[model samples]
Target chain A: MPALANLTSREELLAEALGEGWRPGPPPGGEAEDAPPDLLPKALPLSQVIRVDYVVPGCPPPAPLIGEFFNAFLSGEMPEPGYVFAKVKALCEECPRTREERVLKKIVRPHELLPAPEVCLLDQGMICLGPVTCGGCSAACPSAGMPCTGCLGPTPKAGDMGLAMISALASLVRAGEEGEETIPKEDEILDALVDPIGTLYKFGVPTSLSPLRERAGVRGSSSPYPVPYQRGRGGEEGGGR
Target chain B: MKKIVIDPITRLEGHGKILLYLDEAGGLKDAVLEIPELRGFERFCQGRRAEEMPQITERICGVCPEAHHLASAKALDECYSAEVPEPARLQRELFYDAYIFSDHLLHLVFLGGPDLLLPQDTPKGQRNVLGVLQAHPELGKQVVKVRARAQRILDLIGGKAIHPVFALPGGVAQPLSQEAREEIRGHAQAMVGLAERMVTFFHEQVLPDPGIQSLLLAEECRLPTHYMGLVDEEGAPNFYHGALRIVSAAGEEIYCGDAREALSLIEEHTEPWTYVKFPYLKEFSWQGFSAGVESGIYRVGPLARINVAERMATPLAQEEFERFFDHFGERPVHATFAYHWARLIEMVQAAEDVARLSEEDALTGREVRGELSSPGEGIGVIEAARGTLFHHYKLSPEGLVEFVNLIVATTHNAAGIGLSVKQMAARVVKEGELDERLLNRVEMAFRAYDPCLACATHFLPGETPLAVEIYDAQGVLKQRIVR
Candidate 1:
């Protein structure tokens, strides 16, 4: 038999059926000449026209898990149509790091210092989203000596992985300490966050509690975060989180 | 006359469609393969820390994340003006070989094997890995075992089987353990055996079948286009380190040397219907889409790599390379199906290189990093499994990415695939006598190229199913095939 054909968008399908002179409408509010086409709208629209079967969650699901899914499918043991996921609820459950509660005096970038192999990266002042992201990858990123950016998306209990991480970072910052005049201010703490949208919603923004448009409060805006970072500036105070 | 749209070409990475326009007399008028998915990746990369590119860019495509990761890392090295330590370079090459071996093996056995093993008219449901397993149970078991072993090697070197984070700006993030090195040596040996088995299988099973052999040599599968790839100092195929080489259709050397100069020799042409841009030779002056020798179109990947290289680096692969040339009758094999043959040869070279790298003591050394400096503009190029991949970035002095551009392997073959599809559609769907079998033949032309539209377009997860709709000249639907 021939190989499979392409999976077309709703617009392409409609245009093919409708003949010539049919073009898709400009995206809401005409964001830019080119923007990352939102996949949620394209993928979710199919549910209205056809029966939705199964949903496999992951930014890019692990290969072994995919193999298992295929094996189960080929063997006729696939479960009923719904969400099929790993048993572990959060990435922290699968992480091998030793966790401890301690307030951090400052935020450290991964490139600035080599993290210890055994301790929690977040505790080491590095921004790791394992606490709020889903597991099933066996903590692949952390095991590789890199912090997890939450590619597995938010855990079921978390409304938004980015917000949860922001909250986590805020609580971890040295705050409300008696007579600690050297404690960093709230703005400094927030400034250290760096590319907040990129960190928080790297993979979950499209399907997050606060979608891009809602968060930006502007249709077709490239950045979902309301706070804007000043470009070409050299200081920490130059850009806001 | 009619128009048929094969939307979302299936069994490959990402989303793309094939449009066939026929005249009222049922003669083929025009054919175009369009990529509709766009992630605006360059825009996404802008303003992000240059150091984070390796991690961020790998998420572009699941099939070849290693390629992106390594390419981005190399680009960062240049951006920071840091010379990578020797041991780190060795480790990176070793990790990359494992990736190439596993990726090529997966494509051959899981994706492209069924078309070679099963009959062309086999039912759609059985034209996949499951069917291949049922037909050749022992070989199927070996495929799984070999792929698992390859993945083990990746995990050992990079600390993750998928989307590895081992590469750093000037060096690798960690040193390889002695135990891990030993483990990899064993797996590498096994991979050599697996590669040998694949060669034997291709020669014994695929070549002997008259029908398949004829199809392999079919006119629809031939394209007299230029070939480009990376080659070592001795002009041998080098996946990790090499200079770019381009050879014309008639086996004449066109250009060789610096990748930047080579990149300057090409330009991209955009069509309003597709998001993916068509890259053609700048020397040809953007002549629009056309087929045959004068079209100024070129191809890159396994076949192109083998065509441009003087010989394979490893002994066994060199012998196989000689045999391949002897069979095909010369360099620059125009038959696109020969991509499979070329891919198998590269697999042998990769496995052998892995074994060679595993035996080296440098892999276990601790000096894996180099000092970093202020950021600047840089470019990284590599021979990914699909073809040559380029990642160019410009960073602010503060190390923030100011600009980004990527020309993935799939994009290089985009124009070539379009031409191949046109030729196949004209040959198989003559006079509007369309049928499922003929459509399969058209798809067969596409599969030979192994085009990964997802990587080309830079969007979403892999493996989207494809569907095709046939419309008459009057814009009335006739039939639809969902695979």
Candidate 2:
């Protein structure tokens, strides 16, 4: 597991937050061997021969949380399930990022990382998977956080690849790029949001506008992209550049 | 000869077709096995952020999500030049073990059991596991209990019984608790006992009987063929990770080295006749099939892994491993029928290893992983139930993925399987009765690869071939298409 910590689990969060009251308690301490905190926490079984144990996190939660949860539970006081364990929480309620529309004529880069609380990026005329993304990490990116990059996979209601929601978000961004307060025309929005490569063309105005190619629309292939793109500034070759 | 056709063999994952062409003179002309489905899984991954692949690729196959997750993670690791730290490595090992354990359990008691215990010609109503229960109630109960236990483990680790999403690019997304660890330990022991009983069943009551064995043995399902698999640090069949090797039918090392080199040496070619692509050494394209240790095309999977590995890591498996080799000698067994024996031995080894790993102190720990500070690539390979699976990828500096190529277990044996089918067809089919039972037997030989047609053919199911035509010099069709 990576050094990243997960505050996703109810037991792990309860032990770490054990009365810490809102200060985001020390990144939910536990062993490092647990799960990396970046995505949904899930337990990794000891082996096929043994029956698996369900940890509060996804497959396996952060190691520290696992240890802490173990200690806390072993200590006799059962760690209460966190918000997600409540059985009635919607994904939006769990996410820190809100959604609303605010038209913008230009693109925002990583340098302009400043975030406004309460107002959503889509509403502000920006592209984001935050609202539509699952918030097991308490909207980790937007909350403490960098922008939400959807580590929790997709939100439960979002459907596979969350095509419709992504399309809506991209169209909203395109409308803002066109300097129009509202998307008065569907064809113009579609044209504005297409990717240069037909590959992910289905994913982008319908997806978003990378600053490098504003005219590039999202292609709708099963593939993530036509050409692999490295993420951020790392030299690593990524499917999405 | 009577015509027999088992149109679609039940209990295997994915879709495939088999055809047997016989000449008017009662000689078999060709036996073709075709896979006809494409999911566009890897192709759809292009342009998407690399980080999304772990989950995205999980959708590739519901039957073996762990295989893709492990392979995808390795591919991403390669993209970044990143090596997973020690703790992360241990954690990943444990994580993968959970998946393998669950999957094997699924295959054996669930998918493969019915065929082993029930009569092949038994009425459809009594051919399934449920039917077995009515005949052998105690064994059925044991199988159900084992399945339930395995499912429990899967639910805890992957959040579901089918597709598990526990693995991530750098490491795992979750960890284990002490209570969970102890439960797993208990289960592991019980499973070992069950496996012992199964071995007895195979030896005492199964293998020596009438039915599939006589025809299988007479038909010579044990011929020598080439084999390939991964070699661990200890030079054994390390199922989780290792190096690649290609061994001749006589058990001599042919090609041994890193996976990337293997990739460069092997070429993939598409044939419009089948959905699966053909893979072979660029140098050995025309060797064709032969009766003996011909440098002809061959196969992979369990028998191959057992042959290439110096020895077994577990005690019981090592004992059984010796007996396995003693029967076959140095030559590679080309007979597709031997795959079951090899699979059983590997299963025994995997079970024993699970028992040992379960008791290790490292199995229960708090510091399961370390911090990732570097941006690099990480490659992971494993000897999946089918064959050698390779996962290579490049991750961006910020921890997102860039490029990926998951050469699955089935893909490695694609060309070889096609060749095996053709060879078996040529030897069988004496009278042009178009024997369905013989055809099914030949098909099973290829299915031993458990080829994932989607992964092998770049995720596209080949369209149903209308016919394969061969013409004489006079322009008359030499062979007409027949059902």
Candidate 3:
């Protein structure tokens, strides 16, 4: 927040060009003094808490779209309330990779291997969220040789992004662990899958109907300090990250 | 007695604050630094997979995600006991070079630079990056553009410039194409040129000013303590990969070891007033907030790296390194303000080395990632732009993360930062009065460390957003200065 060369969300080009974005961090550890003791709060997107008038596409809506919003505001041509300022189609519409309509035999975690650049991440066995996510980021992550983690939020299909992703993944992956190349029985892929909830609901959980119930039970740690997200939360000393 | 509060806070208490207690004669009797917020991260990171850590943990701070990403990847490597391929190491290091280059340039030109670049008496509002840019548009614009170009390199490789995702256990995810390497070299060459010009700017424009001279000679914030940094095999300071090295006030070696062994060498002590824990060398034990070779107090970041290492890893930086030592005429430079100069030297090193790393023949190889085994407990350490960053994890048999601990750069420098604040406050406060000078000196004192204050400033509307409230012995408000 220093004054020197301080660039806001508007000024940073990567954010504008690619819709570069992030998820909400955990709630602050300290709370308001006058808050009710029974206030059991779980992290939820603001749209869920209130009647959202209109949705801006990206986590931080990109510049052109922001410009569109303002132009609409100035010209009094604003879209109907409750509308999303993004494409109705899925993020796959913007993806540049090739999709061969192939079934996946194994699940490849992000770290397992170098993803093939020209092939679709989903087609290459990575659980890319492109099919379920809203388009607008121009497939930035996919183009950079990584899978989409859905920072642009859900499409306007009025369905949970994670659940939709789970259904899509179930259809593609076969029943077997990694390194197995055999054709497997139908709908048996669920047995081979692990951490479905984590992989699926990473960003969408805040807005998902099937939000994590385990978060409540997992709220406090045995250590009492509950130093969760140590890397993200525990940073900012010398350079003030 | 009088109490002067720098950044008096109530609701937004997480930002850095200073409490100066003054005697009747106006000399400070005692001083303290307070930061009032921290939360639990270990609780949430436990149930996740280790492979996702580089991506997840990088979200902790927008400024230094690349540091966390690389460090987490290294910890994952240790957890799985994978020997990384030479090509992957080159790729990660090359990526890290751009990160350090960009980050250091940010601090020197934008955050800390504004203070030194402008005159001491410059109005608070005009002393920021905007003020500096308006005054020297060419220098300011060029630095900003170059900084972005460096991020462009990160974007090309890390997949996300701010939140890099290239790193994974044993290696990186993205393989550099021949085209990408060539592009990186072009940008890095431009960056190297800019860094050298800035170094010249530091000499001609900054060093001659009496304001800077005072800051350089100021005894108030001089802290004589242990220094910690990462040193390469040749004992050259390296930001990406090296063993942790700790040296004493008189330049004596104390401890040199890998990240896991570092866990044993250091101990954490917590205060009842704050959640922030003070870490000290376990060998000497915790001996209060005072600093010295005998006490466990240790400092990190640019000054520490320069002090702890034998030489800089690159040529131009090594030249500046020799000049830095000659300027001090001492084994270790303890002057707090010297950190600014040291940081510029580091920037020169980062920019110069980025070009070298870009041209490495192994940079574009196909074996960018290697296979790994089952996860276990492991530790990883790297020098973040701020200072040394530590990440440790323990995994279950199912490969789910079980335990997590991190000693971030801020945590590493907490004790020293607090001590410096107190020292600067005591030196500047005269006769129980709150004035402009106290704000300037105190600001520079902590800004030396480039601390990430958790406090929100936008809520307050003023030229200087912070309000320093002075109170008497009876806890009555004596005077309030908003600057």
Candidate 4:
């Protein structure tokens, strides 16, 4: 049971038969490593090695948080240099917006709400991502205290991800048969993204009614929601609608 | 005499069923598993909110969605008492080692090497993954280049690789880019030379094939029972998050703690024929059985995590774990074919601790996270790839998450793997022989416990034909059904 040319490399066989600790580059940066450049984006690649077009988020992001964001760009700490999708387009300048309400309705479900710290969840009336998203979630859904499930997917001024999820579900419905300054309709953005089709397709992204069914060029069933049941049986229950 | 059924077995991810029976002195009696299907994701995450359950329970497993986003953000950072910062607990153990390196490279290249490199009566259009890329095309291009370098470390910390959303509680809401740590340090040196050629193609082309080592050295197996996982405070093998121990068959350490007292010794009943529920071990819920060896709930996964680890801090996986403490003695190795030698010594201690954290220059970082706060109940256990997966959650003094239980390691070996598949289908089939391919090779050795079933929900529904009765050595009675 040996020969596949006797095998070895789990790092040269645990670095020469397992003393195995390791550290050729990157560590030091965490306690907000001297704050200042807070708004994010230094794009290190461990000491300027390259390929910085970044976006990778969704939770499993750890390996010591990419080795402290590449040891804060190998210590120069350059965050402001832009294009990490423009620091998630300056999360709509710490968002708060209601600027005399842009077409209202009555919508909630951002995990139901209560905490609202720096405000904005679609301008306090809820449905938020602080004005069309991106700000490295530090504004953590109005500041932890919960709501921006954007999961940091889209934010270089939201050009797409289904037009900022149809402008955050036409700013969470209620505008009525599309009027009070428009938006809402298309069956109220399919009832604000069908109650969460597993958090609107977890992180696969795509949405905005999948390019309006590929700009009306229909292909059929791309799951604009529905079909919740069926998953690891034994304790069955349902409801996505 | 012959009756066997596979039901919903193909390409393993979820869904279940296995049954087999026989008698009249020809031999082999009964065995049933059934798990019919009902992912009540803990009653659809009861009443929701617990930090929106780590992005709604990372859509519970498209095969270990980062173990339901690290047991739902460590049960909403323990139901919101949220401390979470030592750089968000070392970036949640480096994205729980890229969710245990793309779920043990998608179960050794697409669910247990397509029936050990395509054959066991092959034809199902050459048995899948394009018949493992036309039989080992360089192990299917090194299993899609070690799952695209474990999907660039799950797309640099949960943006996506299947279902990630940067597990948040007091940290990780997307933060890591030194150009995604030099493309995860050049895909961790090409996944340490494709995990040493997949540990030499799992010990030479799938454990020396004689139909896969006679279902991995079958000595009328199903071992000494009772073992569980997620160790750590020194006990070793801690997949991510810890506590919950339990070990016995003499290795000792009977039950450790935390994981919300995993419903005080896991129970879960119901079996009006099977949507898989059984569970057991509430002190062997009325134990009654005989088979030549003592049995009451034989355990599961990584041999219940190296028999509930009390050691192993990595020195070559602690010298290959002191040769399994003197090769199973004081009543232990009751052979459930040593769950493939405890899944190749926990896949060579997860490829030697992911090549010692990919030669750590602290694995490149940009201050991952901090400041975490807390508002109450929390739990997170790990060791996934099927086994020890707790989660718990409770929260609400304003933090949100009201409740969510979860458990799941196939509901703690569903009643000791249905009493060792009814004592190995009553000692290898014969009595009125019903063999749906030897009960789907005894439910692919109880799917080497890769069971998730969206983390246990307790139960319901059943009765889809599958009958099989037998009794006779003058005890007369027979019936075999699948239709």
Best-matching candidate per lDDT: 1
Off by over 4 Å in 1: A1-57, A62-90, A99-101, A155-158, A175-180, A185-190, A209-241, B291-294, B461-466, B481-483
Ranking of all predicted structures according to lDDT, beginning with the best and ending with the worst: 1, 3, 4, 2
Cα lDDT tens digits for candidate 1, B1-483: 577777666677777667777777878887777666655566657667676788788877777889999999888888888998888898899989999999898888887877787776778889888999998899889889988998898887786767777787888776777988888989998999999998888888877887677766877678889998999999999998788999989888889998755878888766556666678888766676665556678999999999999989999899899988998786689987888888999999999999999988888888787888888988899899999988899998767878788888988888888888888888876735777667777777887777777678776644567677878866788889777
Query: For candidate 4, lDDT tens digit of each residue in A1-241?
Result: 0000012122332222112452122112211211111111111111123333332343333243355457666896634432132233434555443234454455554433332334355544454444544444344344433345555444444534445656566545555554655453545544544334334333333233443334323344343222211211111222121
- Docking verdict class for candidate 2: incorrect
- Reference-based TM-score of each model: 0.85, 0.65, 0.84, 0.32
CA lDDT, every model vs. true structure: 0.74, 0.51, 0.71, 0.53
Q: After superposition, how far is residue B175 of candidate 4 from its true place, in Å?
A: 18
Q: Chain A structural similarity (TM-score) per candidate?
A: 0.62, 0.37, 0.63, 0.24
lDDT of 2 by residue, B80-151 (tens): 444555544654555465555556555555555555566654554565567777867887688678656655
Q: Chain B TM-score for each model?
A: 0.97, 0.84, 0.94, 0.36
Ranking by TM-score: 1, 3, 2, 4
**Model 1, residue A49: C-alpha shift (Å):** 11
Q: Is candidate 2 or 3 superior in TM-score?
A: 3
lDDT of 3 by residue, B1-483 (tens): 666666632211135556666776777777666554333344445567778788776765666778888989888999999898988898888788899889888888677877778887688778778888997899988898899889889887887786766788888777788998888989998899998899888889998999888878767657898999999998888998888899999899888877568877888776533435678899898899898878898988889999998998899999999988998788789988898898988988999888998888988988877778887988889998888888899988777887778777877788898888778776666524457655767777888887654311101111236787777766688788776
Shares of reference contacts reproduced by the candidates, in order, are: 0.18, 0.00, 0.19, 0.01
Candidate of highest DockQ: 1
